[model samples]
Target: MAKTVVQEFTKGLWAEIPPFRLVLGLCPTLAVTKSVDGGIGMGIATTFVLVCSNILISLLRNVIPKQVRIACFIVIIATFVTVVELLMQAFTYALFLQLGIFIPLIVVNCILLGRAEAFAFKNKLISSLADGLGIGIGYTLALAALAALREILGNGTFYNIPIFGPSFQPFTFMVQAPGAFICLGLMLAGMNMLGKK
Candidate 1:
């Protein structure tokens, strides 16, 4: 029993990382990763929804009809996403504005739906919660890594903290839309290589 639980928990970290391995939440992954702060905010918001929806879905798995499972999961996930959006607006208005549409877009993030259908619906509550946490953290870390690279090169700063001397020239392109594709492709390639080794 313990071993099964451990496997379930760890599977999400690398074996099924929502962004890197599964590629389920690319919209937010690519959209909100312009800055470390934005990536972290998006990660936390998604994590909240993932964890809440997973637990709820797991608990109601037996009751929700097979045909309506997707609909039910969406409603649950949307509720939590809305809560996170409102909280961000109330406490971090500037950040919220920066995130804009991507904040609400969490409702449709495939990671949440995939987990609800694939893992949460079949697993126990504890195991589902563990999966949610592992996947959420994995996604968050990937976004943070990408954001760190972009911020450092594009702005000569790391998470708003200056790391280079004033004489250093910043790569203005690193923060642009094209930069997102470049960084994500490189990061995904690196992750795949590392996984093989």
Candidate 2:
């Protein structure tokens, strides 16, 4: 009846996916998903912060006082978020520009702090690693799926490759804010459908 380390990891992929299955971290998810590249960029950046913060928090769990633990977690999470921002700026400047402020804003993402307080603070090193990775990948996949749909519908392109023929008309609105909300809503509905099956 005990869960394996792999189960702890894999659960984040579908069972407890954030911004969708778990309904956590919707801000950046909707903010940067206009294009597959930007969405993936934000996803990886968040994943980096998530995994690094989770590992560090798990390691320091016993050392941190319960009263001040949230502050410590934020400091730790912010440190990694800064690292991700710098790496994105240096290595992926274009995607960096596309994502803009959302990169640094990852520090406030609830999913990172939620995992730190709820899971990493109480779990072992490997289990925390799996949980972070699973959650990160789940978030990345969700962003990529949404971005793909938005790009294809709004721009008639997949990663700017032009998926639909020239005759296809792009629904430019699909890449806008209203489109983000609509896409997110539809995606959640799809997840619900899948969950019911």
Candidate 3:
């Protein structure tokens, strides 16, 4: 029983990673991944909201009316998102600027809502916490990886620190809109191939 719970907690680290295997919450994944800084900031913010909302939702799972459950979940999620937004804006103005609309948009992030409805709503508080943390970490890692790729290849830097030297010619397009889609798609393909192996 204890081992099973640990498995549930660890699954989201790779197996059910968001915007990769699960394919939820792509908006922030794509929007804030241009820079590693923005990616890390946004990822942590989303994780904070996700974990908070999941805990609340799991605790209130039975009290919430069936008809109004979605509304309740939204309220809980929005409340946490607001907290994250204000904290980010107050402490990390530059990253907040980079994340911009995506911060508030966390209220509607599918991963948060989906877990609230599908997992948290049905699980114990401990299980829900594990799920939220695992999924949140997965989301964060995905964003960071994508941001690192774009930052290194597209901008010739890692975390805004020069990496490739003066001779490196950045791809430039890797940071563009089309490039985001292409990069994510390629990554998804790579993941699929690895999963099959």
**How close is each model in CA RMSD to the real structure?**
1.1, 1.3, 0.8
Clashes of each: 0, 1, 0
Candidate 3 per-residue C-alpha lDDT over 94-184 given as tens digits, one digit per residue, 9 for 90 to 100: 8888888999999999999999999999998888888999999989999999999888889999999999879999999999877788889
Report the lDDT of model 1 for residue 6.
82
What's the lDDT for all of these models?
Answer: 0.88, 0.91, 0.90
Q: After superposition, how far is residue 79 of candidate 1 from its true place, in Å?
A: 0.8
Top-lDDT structure, candidate number? 2
* Tens-place lDDT digits, model 1, residues 1-197: 78877887788778887777887788888888888998988888888899999999999999999999899999999999989988998999999998999988888888899989999999989999988988888888888888999989989998899999999999888898888889989988998999999
Candidate number with the higher lDDT (1 or 3):
3
Q: Which 10-residue window of candidate 3 scores lowest in summed lDDT? A: 1-10
Error of 1 at 5 (Å): 2.3
Clashing pairs in 2: 19-24
Candidate number with the higher lDDT (2 or 3): 2
- Work out the TM-score per prediction: 0.96, 0.97, 0.98
In model 3, the runs with Cα more than 4 Å from the true position are: none
lDDT of model 2, residue 159: 89
